[model samples]
Target: MKVKRPGLVTVIVDLNFLNVFLLIVSFFPKSKFIEQFGFYFNPTPSFFGGYN
Candidate 1:
């Protein structure tokens, strides 16, 4: 079976969602997970629809 790779748009969308999730996580002051993955919330809307 041949596995097809996702397009760039799909990858960007996925990353955007991840960034949004991390942003929400940031709401909680006690959340340390986001800190570990720092820099994910720096994405601009022009790049990934503001999910960063």
Candidate 2:
């Protein structure tokens, strides 16, 4: 059996996306748009725990 790891570029891209998302979430913590869509989209309690 063999397992293949993700490519370096893929990992970097994913991290970049995560950073951007966190930035947006942090900036708009109390915005109406975030309140309405963030939970619906992310639905990760821990991800939002720090902000609240």
Candidate 3:
């Protein structure tokens, strides 16, 4: 059996997307949009535990 890895371009794009997502979350940590996004991302209360 053989395992396949993501190509360099895919990895780079994923990292870039992660960076931009983090930037947006950081810039508006207290905004309703972030809160809603976080909830949908992880419905657990601990999702935003540190922020509180």
Candidate 4:
């Protein structure tokens, strides 16, 4: 049997969730913590690119 792939809606929803999460973290004084770990996911192109 072939494995099913995620739909476009699923991919979009996941990205939106991540955006909201990062936005919330950016408001906190300890956002540096998020940045430190976010590097592992290469968030710079999406998150930091928009903010900066």
lDDT of each: 0.70, 0.71, 0.70, 0.68
* Candidate 1 structure lDDT: 0.70
Q: Assess candidate 3 and give its lDDT.
A: 0.70
Task: State in Å the error of residue 42, model 3.
Answer: 16
lDDT of 3 by residue, 1-52 (tens): 9977679978999999999988877765557786676533433355657543
Residue-pair clashes per candidate, as listed?
A: 1, 0, 0, 0
Q: Compute each candidate's TM-score over C-alphas.
A: 0.46, 0.43, 0.45, 0.48
- The candidate 4 region of ten consecutive residues with least summed lDDT is 39-48
- In the range 1-52, model 1's lDDT, one tens digit per residue, is 9977779878999999988986778686455665676634444466656563
Listing every candidate in turn, what is its Cα RMSD in Å to the true structure after a full C-alpha superposition? Answer: 10.2, 9.8, 9.1, 9.4
Better of 1 and 2 by lDDT: 2
lDDT of 4 by residue, 1-52 (tens): 9977679878999999999987777666445576677533333445546733
**Top candidate (lDDT):** 2
lDDT of 4 at 51: 39
lDDT of candidate 2 over 1-52, digit per residue (tens): 8977679978999999999997878765556777676443443456656542
